[model samples]
Target: MNTLLTSLPKSTPLPRYATRLLGAALSATAYAVCLPWDLRNRAETAGAINETSPVTALGVTFLSLSLLSLAAYFGIRDRLSWTLLVVAAPPATLLYASLSSHPTQDANAWPVAWAFFTLVLGAGVLVAGSVARQFGPRAR
Candidate 1:
């Protein structure tokens, strides 16, 4: 008697689309939500975004590249660099978020809610990235 299940692969990958799109989207959204809010206050947003002032700006660029790499990763498996970029994005974005937000409003306010969403999305991407094995292309 065969006990094998055909639907499941030996690979323990996160859903490829979720990891690729969600990770990049979360990183972008987090930066979108937090960066402007901080800047609007006329504060030096960099101070709150972690690391040296110049480095935080660099991190923003890095996350943006990471997101683009996630798209690129979907198209080409030959380049190992895309994997690193996608993998690195969540933590870097989260680091910026954690440092940037000051919670000027009530805890339940829209800004706060949006910020929280960004955090959850960023963290979820990290969790998903750990397990993502890029499955869909094979299914096709």
Candidate 2:
């Protein structure tokens, strides 16, 4: 058994950035697919939902994804930069909520909010990864 194990090549783990990127992509895709399904399900079973209901669901999903990503980020060998990425979730969520909410806002604003959230989240992740590469513990 020891001889066979030694003969096999060691599996290499993915880099921190690659994993983070993947997690973000998956989470975004899940959100996209689940949101409409959730809305439809709610409407069919519970009647018309309040304006804030969808938003609240979205927030919960986002928070769950963020926490999962953070947990994955912690497993990486280089954690300094990934910390920034995980830490941005709360503020980003608040910004998303504020921008997407208005008593008088129309349905048109929903698409805009989705786009804005996607862009901001992507940019933040990229920046965090870059900063981690440049100034993280590995740099020293």
Candidate 3:
């Protein structure tokens, strides 16, 4: 049993808070970049600036893939609390976008669908992380 264990590859453990920071940073960066495009697309569609395009769907897919991957990586190597930290990025960024976009307007200009999608995506991230943790290697 000892020899078998010795022959297996070892992975470096992530430091505490590493997952939290990395996950949040990745999520925030993704949202910062994608949200602007999403907003522009929505505004144009509403104003009839041009016909709608596939960019919106592509952006959403990209965000989903990237965020889910980040969550899974954290879940496989770190605790669940750290993985959950990723969920905070969406609302924080959304608030920033809202205030910056329309400080005087009483109504929010961003689409409500995205706010709802945040909840759904967050839950998906949690589930992905939880599932990954189940398959991760256990410490001795």
Candidate 4:
């Protein structure tokens, strides 16, 4: 099991373009899912009906699944996947917004979340550059 776990990253190597496109798609999906939730939350906070619709629940479920998938995909590698990192950004942004808007019992936790988000975004940029370098023309 340990050997299989160690070899997982080597088993799934995606191309640069594919990675970028997938990342963009995933990010867009995350944004789409979160937007409605955000709007609903705002409406509720303004004393509107606080109802849990099935669609909202499903959207949240999808968001959770995407986050989990991203973590698992990126966790296996020494070098993170830029696509997965991009996928992580929206949810992280939502987390930041949540933390900022309502200070919970543990307001101090936001900094750690912020740091993690920064790290993921930074790693995405670095890995993207590395992937881009591989696209250069080869010598004869």
Candidate 5:
């Protein structure tokens, strides 16, 4: 019995760092998938394109943010600091990608504005994650 116990393999959990990375990746992908809708809305607002369905755009935004929140929830787990990284990834990616396309000072402000908006959304993501940590399925 002692020899059998000694031969049993230990189960290894995923490293927190890896989970954080996975969360960031999922968050960024969610943003990337939804960016086109945002860009189209911007273009329509600028009169560079025809109008689009406000409902569709709103739905996309909600879906993307939901994805981000879930990513933060699962990725951050018990680590508060991980929330910062996971929350920032999507907006950082968007801001960086938009910088090269800023054709004028006025146009440049849009990205900054969007970044601020996303930052607010990111705060919500953090709250959602914290709430889930306290009450969701895996909650202790």
Candidate 6:
């Protein structure tokens, strides 16, 4: 039994770390939702809804959940999480940009850019977290 436990992957899964990942991912999601809200504020004045509203909401939700799922993946430090997050980010950005009501070309580009930034950051988190989990020590 001891030998079997010792042979397990170093990067098994840590519940505490997983919780932190979840919290951070959820926070990222909250930030995502705030993006459109901020944009909406800047576009006109008072809070308003447009065609992009649902898109923005959906984008925020997906990104948030993606991030959360990524964290959960990292809790296990699985390679697939890293892969999915890296791949899914760009399309999500496109979807986010398309949903935006930004006026100028440059302005419209910010949401996607921001999304990319967050995704990159999320990737970092996943990589680091996964590595830590992998290198972590075994119990006696």
lDDT by residue for model 6 over 12-90, one digit each (tens)?
5574345335544554454455343434434233554322343466665665555554444434433435434443443
lDDT of 5 by residue, 1-140 (tens): 33211211121244545555676777676666555433433455675543453345765676556665664465335454456567665656665665445445443466667667667766766666676566543454
Best by TM-score: 3
Cα lDDT, all candidates: 0.44, 0.46, 0.60, 0.50, 0.55, 0.47
- The candidate with the higher TM-score, 1 or 4, is 4
Give the local distance difference test score of model 4. Answer: 0.50
Q: Write the per-residue lDDT of candidate 2 for residues 24-78, one digit (tens) a residue.
A: 4554454444342232222334544444345466665675466445433432333
Query: Which tens-of-lDDT digit does each residue in 76-117 have in candidate 4?
Result: 422444434555666566556654664244235667877786
Segments in model 1 whose C-alpha atoms lie over 4 Å from true places: 1-9, 12-57, 70-140
Question: Which pairs clash in model 4?
Answer: none
Model 5, C-alpha of 40: deviation from truth (Å): 9.7
The C-alpha RMSD of each candidate to the native structure, in angstroms, is: 11.8, 9.8, 6.6, 10.8, 7.6, 9.4
Tell me the TM-score of each prediction against the true structure: 0.27, 0.37, 0.61, 0.38, 0.60, 0.35
User: How does model 1 score by TM-score?
Assistant: 0.27
1-140 per-residue lDDT for model 3 (tens digits): 33222211233344344435656777877766654433333434565534343346777777778777777777776566656665455545664564456323345544564567556776887899888777665533
Alpha-carbon deviation at 9 in model 5, angstroms: 22
Better of 1 and 5 by TM-score: 5
**Candidate 1: lDDT of 123?**
52
Q: lDDT per residue, candidate 1, 1-140, as tens digits?
A: 12111222232445543444564565456455434433333334554533223336666565545544453343233223334445445555555564556445334254555567555544544434333334333334
Instruction: List pairs with backbone clashes in candidate 1.
Output: none
| Residue 8 local lDDT, model 1 | 22
